[model samples]
Target: MDGSVMQDTDLAVLLHQVQHRTASPEIVSSDCSASPPAVLPKRVAAAFASTDGDSDSGGDSLLRPKKLRKPTDSGGDSLLRPKKLRKPTYAARKEEIAALLEEHRLLQARLELLRQNVGIPTSYDHDTLEAAQRQQRAMEEALRLQQFALGNTQSLFSKHMNALEPNPLKTYIHLTTDAVERRNTLLSIRREKLHRCYQFVHERLHHIPETSPYHVEERYVNAKGDRIISRFERLLFPGVQDVKQVFNALLFYLTNMEISISETLGHVTVRDDIDAVETRVSNHRVVSSTSYGIELELNAVHCYEYYEKFEEMGGQEFAME
Candidate 1:
């Protein structure tokens, strides 16, 4: 009977302790509801939730899903937005008009200056001025030819000869049929002489060594040493016996015919006529050739002398219709 009573007492005390523990939580919850709940700092709550592993049951309510933030693009927004264009102000329009007027004034000034420089009168039309210039040039050319025919060598046209202006009067005087025939005959005789001289020089060069100098270099050495003399120098200063004889014959013909070598290359051709006589001396040989038109003119004195020589040479005469 004593053991039963003790067991019932222990059982009742354990049940009362269990009921008290369960009711104590309800009372605390009701008190928390009745008053305002205690606010925890965000950083403290986050630290407590992360550090305490058992906080899932209680702290899950404190952490609502973080509100997602959309990414911002300022540059893209600015680009997508339409730009508002401002209307031009009265002052800006006035400035543009002023600048255009200034440019117009400058262009007009330049045009006026150009007209003055070109000697184009404001009253004259451009085509009229051009026609006048053409007429003036024709008159000048006519006057020049008249002066040239009258034996005026100091004419304005002759002064500008270096400017490459062709003289029609000179061409007419030198390129006539009679002039061409006489010049061709004279040139043929000269050509024959040149050929003979070339043959002699070519033969002489063959007899000399390859090392023998043809052109003048080191005057003392060339004059003293066994160097070949150029035809030009031989013609000018005849030292060798054979060269003197050859040049003497050429001089006699030149004097009798009254023909002068006016050019450095021993060519006598009319002005404005293209004539070339190329002669290259190298390697014991003389290669000479001529090209283009050959023309010349003779005075009355020379013409008589030329006919006399032609008769002496027994040239056949032909009548021109």
Candidate 2:
């Protein structure tokens, strides 16, 4: 067998074995991490020159073919390799994914807004806001309740007071009765101290004449500072004792120690109702001397000596006892 033919036969056998294998084609590998080989590009081939024997002259070298690659003029070492596009990518079905992502973003925003709204206290902020509102409402309600209660209390108080008012005529009448009661109680008391005090005051009792013992004397002063005296009769109501004057003067003289009745007694004389005179003189016991002047100014108020001492009911305390 010829050597060349034997070499050719071996090469053919190897090629046949490689073509029959079931494995699919492999992608081209690159060491520089350049893009994967494209379908077509400018091809570079290895060159060789032939040396002519015995001289520096050269003949054409063998034309070596090279594997083609894709080219890019862009200023990048490499571009991202596109993955082999699948059915989803090839069909361009991305609208649904975009919509889902958008919905998710919206949900996050809604959750943030819900956190700001007031509700049952899950946190301190919510608790504070709710408590403040509750307190404000409670204060308003309390104020309203207080006003209502005040109104009701005022109305009730007024009604009660009105029902309990004392009558004017009965008021003075009651005062006189109380004084009589005091006198009787004091007299009845066996206590020597109380009896002595009551008797002393009791003797001063006299019916009050509208006229007073004191007189107002008016004097006119000249520029030289000298004074002139105008003497007047004691002012009197004619029938107070019914005797007019003389009897009042006698009683005044007899009862008072140093106290002098006004001199008007010398001018007017005589009387008829001895009992009336006696009654007037008798009513003056406790209050007459002190209260008389005040009575002149206080017309609206009528003064009566209601009690000289306590009533007989265990001594005297008029209103209370």
TM-score of each: 0.17, 0.21
Model 2: residue 191 alpha-carbon error in angstroms: 16
* Model 2 lDDT per residue over 1-321, tens place: 699797667655543442232122242123212322343121200001111121123221121124466666552334655557566773455876788889998986677567767453344566788999999999999999999999999778545533433411222212234655644443333244334434533433334343575343445554456554533334445555433244445445444422332243222222222111222222232112232332111111112122335565355432110
List ranges where model 1 is wrong by over 4 Å. 1-103, 106-195, 198-224, 231-321
Per-residue error for 24 in candidate 2, Å, reads: 32
lDDT tens readout by residue for model 1, 223-294: 235332223121233364543355346535434332234344455433221222121110111222224445
Candidate 2, residue 78: the lDDT equals 43
Best by TM-score: 2
Scored against the true structure, residue 145 in model 1 reaches a CA lDDT of: 92
Q: Give lDDT for model 2.
A: 0.40
